[model samples]
Target chain A: MVEPLVELKGVSKSFGSKKILDNVDLKIYPGDALGVIGPSGTGKSTILRIIAGLLKPDAGEVYIQGQKRQGTIEEGEPSLGVGMVFQQSALFDSLTVDENIGFALYRYSKLPPKKIRELVERKLEIVGLPGTGDLYPAELSGGMRKKVSLARAIITDPNNPDNAPCMILYDEPTAGLDPIASTRIENLIHDLLFKQGLCRAYAIVTHQASTIRLTTERIIFIYQGKIQWDGKREEAYVSTHPLLKQFFSGSIEGPIP
Target chain B: MNRILSSSGLWSWIQRSWAAILLSGKAIFFLITRKLDFSSSLEQMMAVGPASLLIALVTASVIGMIFTIQVAREFLQLGAGSAVGGILAIALARELCPVMMAVVVAGRVGSAFAAEIGTMKVTEQIDALYMLNTDPIEYLVIPRLVACCIMVPALSILALFTGLTGGLIVAQMYGIADTVYLDSIYNFLDVWDILSGPIKGVVFGALIAIIGCSWGLTTRGGAKGVGQSTTAAVVTSLLAIFVSDLFLSWLMFQGLGQGATMIGQ
Candidate 1:
């Protein structure tokens, strides 16, 4: 059996009095397009943050490429790079799109300015935002900022292949976009996976149905701080799990509370 | 209820103060290791130094003129007109210039640091920096610290000179000769007295930078959090300046009877 790129064994996390993730065991293998769906205020995004090494679990362990992570990313990074696209696009308002995209490279890599600019331009083109490099985050629309952040997430230094993210964790990539914009982002996610092959796997936390159906192959339904159901995308639609049924139906009454 | 609220508030202040101290320690470690970002430091220096020069100079000058005006009349009435410039110089160097410059910067640049970083924190841009493998301390806090440490002293020194010049002009206006004013300053102001302003400035600058950055990094909620952090940072910085000034003054000028002896002479 192929080894999973990332695994969480009995992981748990809490904020203040509220437990966000409760003994959550999860795994993501190469080539996986996973969707994490849940009611609002559940720990859907928390899972992604844990996987990305941005947040530490209150209990249990996280394994990246089968090696147990000893501490948060600040202490030591995983063997594989994990890129995250934040829900709000989180671009540095002070930086231009090119500066934002080329931030990691400019800070970490020995690549010259011209080479970095070329790479940033290429990533911009890949994300369908060519010639928008000079614009700041404030100048870009919400969708455009999301695309810029995507470009930033995928822009890697050719000189440092180890720094390239093997897994991408997206937090509500289509949360506030219009339908057309959401579709565009969903299609771009597919193109990145299938065409560009920028990352080996990705997990998206989203509430949009179109995003779940169009971009994910595997699905997990989280409620009450635990994964209530895990199955293939087709199984998610027909599963008899009451939590999934209630969630998909958008009912006021459910086991979620 | 009031006791509980006040205790919680005190605890929060202690927590913030501790965080700022840790941040300052880390910044000092980074500085000693020579892991400085020169570009960002230069940018911050421009913001903290030259951009604030006009206001600092203006405030210092007015303060000097007012002091001379107040002292010249009293001293001349007592046949001690020659001592007016000396007293003004001592006050400007040992207290006014450093404290006033710090207060101005704590209000202006310190507040900006908190608001900007607080916004970044709430917007997740600080997290984005972490995701990009950039330590926010190294990227954001260190440069600001370095700028304040270097520029605040420089600004205080300039303000001291401006205040002295203003005092000299006012002394001349009060019928005191320029030579007498200059002689009085030379007699009263020693090397340590001249250096005190910059020394106090360095301490106040570190306080302002560390407090502002700490408030920002700990900011929660959203826009409201940013505003609160900004306000708290400035208030904390000002309080720190005044309290530290008291200790510094005592340490630097304790048991000094030179002024009394000079007056007897």
Candidate 2:
């Protein structure tokens, strides 16, 4: 059996009386690019936050590489070795592109400044942004900012130094991009994950159907705080379940309410 | 119904502001732990401090001239215009110099810090920091706090000297040449007056930094939220300085009185 890179058992979350996630049980195998699809506010992002240990579940256990990770986030420490790219390109406007990417390696690295600069350059080059370090977030176009943010996320590439159960938790990575940009981003996602091959895993939270088709091998659809369907991505659209039909149908009135 | 709704809406806004402050306090405490970009902090200080010098100089000069004019006018009419030097020293040392300098900084640079940080926060860059295993406070708060602390006092000292110089020119212009202006001014402006204001400045810098950074970290609701926090930081820090000024003034006065009275007794 392939080692589960991440596991959630009976996880539940609520904001006031509104339940966001309900008994979410999931497992991501090593190197699997799992796509989580759902309508807005269906707790897709909440699950990502849970897996990254950013938000604690009201009940249930969360395991990263099968080790429980919780309580540390509330205390201002992210225990899971998960990197996240938020729905919005959350790059720091104040810091230049080089500084932004360099943040990940600023600590916990013994490399000298000259060496670190080389490493940072390599990370940017991998993202197709070569020799544009001094530029601020404001200078970049939307798609460019998203790519810079992606470069920042994989700055360390845990597989490079240690196989640390690394997972890139992408939140709407291609949501705001144009079709061409979206396709490019989607391809990058697959290429990066393929590079992970049998070493790193990935989880994406998004609403775009095309993004779902291109990258994710496995799929889970969330609705009303629970998993409505879980299977291969190709099977999701054809699933006869009422929830999947209503969601994929883009109906105004669906099983969601 | 309208009146009730308006009152409730006002009440929640106030409540939300208070909660944001409290929540940001915890975040600030976490942020000051050395997680922020050190190079950025150094660069920020260099940027903010060097740029503010001209403003401080202008403010100091104007305040000095005004103090000298007021004192010299009153003294000239009373045949005590010879004491213009003493009057300027008393005014600049006791109250005007440090207070004015710090207020200017709080208004100009402090607001800038709050707006910059608040916008970054609303955009989710700080969330990115967490994802990267970097503590936002260490990365964001410390450098800013350190910069403000160093810059406020440095500017205050510059303000003090330039302010005294401004008074000297005014005194010389008014022909209050009988008394030794420089010597008298120096004598009247005591150690307490000089020391107390800077001490207040150190405290004021801390207040400005905490309020600004806290507001930034706790900002929500997007761009409008950033604007709101920036405005709140400037308003609150200035208000804090003024309100605390009363107590600080009283403490300095009372402390001086006791020391003088003891000597007389």
Candidate 3:
């Protein structure tokens, strides 16, 4: 049996008096493309953050490549590199595109600036934003900024394969984008996963129907701090799960509320 | 009133204060270990030092002129015209220059640090920094702390000289010859008095940077949060400076041992 790349067992998180996740067990295997879909404020993003080791669960264990995570990312390095693409792109406004993409390399890698720049340019080319190394985040369009952030997520140290991301978690990667822009991002995500083999596993948290249909092979529907339904992508549309039906049909007449 | 005291606002402030203290401790540790980004520190120095020089000098000059105006007439009427320069120098070195420069920087640079970092916090750039395997304290707070620590003192020294020059010019205008003013300063001002300004500046700079950066890192909400953090950071820095100044003043000049004896001469 293939081991799961990442697993969250009985993970729970809360904010103040509001509980976001409750004893949620989730697992992602190598080559898995999972979509986590739910209504707003349902803790999809929180799950991604927990998986990336950016946020610790109030209760439970997170196993990264079979190693029980000890603490938050600040405490120690994870067994595998987990890259996260934020909903807001989160690029440093003061740095150029190249600098934003090559931030980790410039800070931690033994490579020279010239080599880092070359790698940054190569990542930019992969993200289809070539020759944009000199431009700031403010100068780019919203979609371009998203692409730039994608490029940043995929950048890795050439000499240190251990540091390369084995799993990528994208939080709302296609939200706030026009359909055409969403299609481009979806295509790029597919290319990175299937053609480029950038990561062994990935998860996307998005509300976009097209993105869920196009980019994900498996789907999990969350509601009221628990997983309502879990199944393959194709079965999501036809499932009789009341919350899933209401969520897919855009109906207010169900258990979702 | 109990409800007000128990409000989340108060709790949040406590949390932020604790976070700031932790950040300051971490930054000092990194500084001791020499684990810092030199380029970032240099960039922050430019912002904290040369960029703020003009305002600091202007403030010091105006203060000097004002103090001289207030004291020269009184001193001259008492047949002690030569004491004006020494008094001005002592006042500037002991209290005025360091406090005034700190206030100026707290308003200018401290507020800016809070707003910039608060925005980054709201936008998740701080989390992104963590994702990229960068410690935000080492990358962000230490540089600002280093800049403020180094430059605030440098600015205080410069401001002290500028204030003296301003007092000298004003004294000359008041018919107390430049020679008289120079002689008085030479006789009355001790080396410790001159060194105290920069010493206080180093302490105040640390307060400003640490408070500002801590408020920023603990910022919640969005634009309104950033605005509040910026305001709170400046206000907190100002309060910290004044409170620390009281203790620093006491520690450095508790008793009038030397200055009083020099006056007896």
Candidate achieving the largest TM-score: 3
For candidate 2, list the clashing residue pairs, or say none: B31-B137, B31-B138, B35-B138, B35-B139, B36-B138, B36-B139
DockQ order, best first, reads 3, 1, 2
Superpose all Cα atoms of candidate 3 onto the true structure and report the RMSD in Å to 1 decimal.
Answer: 1.4
Q: CA shift at B87, candidate 3, in angstroms?
A: 0.2
| lDDT (tens digit, per residue) of candidate 3 on A145-199 | 9999999999888898877888899999988999999999999998899999988
Model 1 interface DockQ:
0.65
List candidate 3 segments past 4 Å from native: A77-79, B6-8, B260-265
Q: Per model, how many backbone clashes are there?
A: 0, 6, 0
> RMSD of each candidate?
1.6, 3.7, 1.4
**What lDDT score goes with residue B8 in model 1?**
71
Model 3, B96-127: lDDT tens digits are 99999999999999999999999999999998
The 0-to-1 C-alpha lDDT of every candidate, in the order given, reads 0.89, 0.77, 0.91
lDDT of 1 by residue, A156-244 (tens): 88987877888888999998999999998999987898789999889999999999999999999888788888889999999888888
Better of 2 and 3 by TM-score: 3
lDDT of 2 by residue, A135-169 (tens): 99889988888888888777664434552337888
* Fraction of native contacts under 8 Å reproduced by each candidate: 0.62, 0.69, 0.72
The per-residue C-alpha lDDT of model 2 at residue B50 equals: 84
lDDT of 1 by residue, B1-265 (tens): 7678577777677778898988888888878875688999999999999999999999999999999999999989988887888888899999999999999999999999999999999988988888898888889999999899988889899988899899999998999999888888889889999899999999999999999998999888989889989999999999999999999999988884475445423
